[model samples]
Target: MSIYRTIGIIGAMAEELELLHRHAQMESETVKAGLVFYRGTLHGMNIIAVKSGVGKVNAAVCTQALIDLGAECILFTGVAGAVDSSLTIGDIVVSTACVQHDMDVTALGFAPGAIPYQEISVFPADEELRSLAVRASRDAVNGRVLEGVVLSGDQFIASRDKVQSLRDVFQGACAEMEGAAVAQVAHMNGIPYVVIRSMSDQADGSAHMNFAEFTVLAAGQSYAVIEGMVRSLQQA
Candidate 1:
């Protein structure tokens, strides 16, 4: 038996979700709100996996739908661009916290990245889940595994200046298009959630080329980590 009755797993790309789907047993799928949710069991745990389209709005929508369907917790797995230069392709980053790098409202006197009513920027991941992710990454990933803040924005970071700017502001390990938005939605709903990512690029001018060449390898690394996490939960 698993600790949670039902877990929600979300990814922005088809490749990410496909890997999970292939591993699922007794799976059934339903489409709603332009997203497809796959309900099944993985490693003895009940799961709902969805391929959320790219970007923040898409991620939030999928998360809310998962919540409406009675998901107790959410897990996001995908590839990210490395914000810290020390990170390399296939290295895993398990998010300890998440922030929307594009959420700037300084003109309204709110600090950059702060939500108007919340008056806060960074949102912490669920400690228990983050810890489990770290352990799983250590067990499964071949490259370095790190736990740090992850920044999300609509833009795909592909320039040195943009990457440096985000790192300077958020001090994050990785940058992606959707993680922070999913984190915010989960936070508001009082659901525990964690974000796990594999670095596919350095978030520099060569990012696009690097991503195209290494995304498959990075995704495989992330999938292994996620599998290890599910196994850990099943045993726990």
Candidate 2:
């Protein structure tokens, strides 16, 4: 008896999504936008899950597709590079809002991270959903659970300089390729959305190595949080 009728979930990679797929009672599969969307039931709530691949356009396409398929809410989950200095690998970040860190319009004085012409550039997460996610995350993860902005870009953050830039510009807890785009779509569609990221790397010189070693662990943390959220919603 969740308040939301159906939840759409988008994961950024195979490892990010593989475990959850096994848990959901998949009823049907649809292939669209080069992504396989699994329609199913999880924790007594209707869910449509998909691996959104990577990057902004792919994530945006995945979100809209889920909406078209009747998802009332969107949940985007995956691992990301930590941008905040306080964050460590394995920390979980539940986005209060999302921003495209790469969306620069500085020349036109639109300010960094602003999507020109849009009423709001930094898309917001649903307040109710955000609270639910935060509560669930604390219960689900052994690591630190944080509430902050999620920064998205088409690039894999590896440089320390770039990480500092993002930290100064957006104050994001995590930086990834897809979450903000998903947020943008959900915002435009007037659908409630939440983006969850578990830190796999520090977005520094050793990021790639760290990401390779910790992505699965980080993804597991994120999945647990998602499960916790679904259970909370169902019981509510």
Candidate 3:
């Protein structure tokens, strides 16, 4: 209803959304609500940021809804557990591509990690947006920016052994519950999108033990990176 241009942002949890919303409010125009959309003007650009709840289905549904509401680009921002040894809590992972780690189709004659009914095993991110995210993460914090594949699954991977297995198999940088699904939705709709996640915990050894303690700092760093990306996108 207002100006028409829109960028969709999907936050996987309430805390994540709260951070994004707080940043949005600091912009000049307050967000306006529609039947299924929350519209705001940030740096003179229209944005619709929504909490996609959790899991793959929820993320996909919310993404589709945003696209239907006229979003041209979708950005999935939130926290993830680190899969790579080089990463640490609070580091940013800017995805080069995403895959569903939980997907298994070998029994049905499809390869493991491939989406059912889909030919491609990997879904790539929008290059331009990925570049912007990398720069933003570097600018936002002294945190290192890891540009690698992201693996998404239904499980919350806090197990070191399990995380190591996944890392060995997929060589993924981070593990989250929603990135691949969000990417799939965007790909299907022919819309541009990118997944940006901050490391909330190490996927190995003490991941489970330290998750509670690391979440606050992880989410805060994640918010700053995403906020910087939003601002960068506006400049672009």
Best by lDDT: 2
lDDT of 1 by residue, 51-74 (tens): 889999999999999989878989
Each model's lDDT comes to 0.87, 0.89, 0.80
Q: Write the per-residue lDDT of candidate 2 for residues 1-236, one digit (tens) a residue.
A: 77788888889899988878878889999988777889899888999898888899998898898899889998888899898888898888989999999999999989999888888998889998899888888887788988999999999999999999998888888899998999999999999999888889998999977888898898888788888888888888
Model 3: per-residue Cα lDDT over 1-236, one tens digit each: 22226777778876776776676753332222322356776666678877887899888888888887778988888889899989988888999999999998779887669877766769899998899788888887677889999999999887878888897889999999999999988898888888988888887667778877777776676677667766776666
Model 3, position 115, has a per-residue lDDT of 73
Better of 1 and 2 by lDDT: 2
Cα displacement (Å) at residue 36, model 2: 1.2
* Number of clashing pairs per prediction, in order: 0, 0, 0
Q: Candidates ranked by lDDT, best first?
A: 2, 1, 3
Better candidate number, 1 or 3, judged by TM-score: 1
Q: What range of 10 consecutive residues in model 1 has the weakest lDDT sum?
A: 17-26
TM-score of each: 0.96, 0.97, 0.89
Ranking by TM-score: 2, 1, 3
Better of 2 and 3 by lDDT: 2
Q: Tell me each candidate's RMSD, in Å, in order.
A: 1.2, 1.0, 3.7
- Summed over model 3, clashes come to 0
Best by TM-score: 2
**Where in model 3 is the C-alpha error above 4 Å?**
1-4, 25-36
lDDT of 2 at 163: 93
TM-score of 3: 0.89
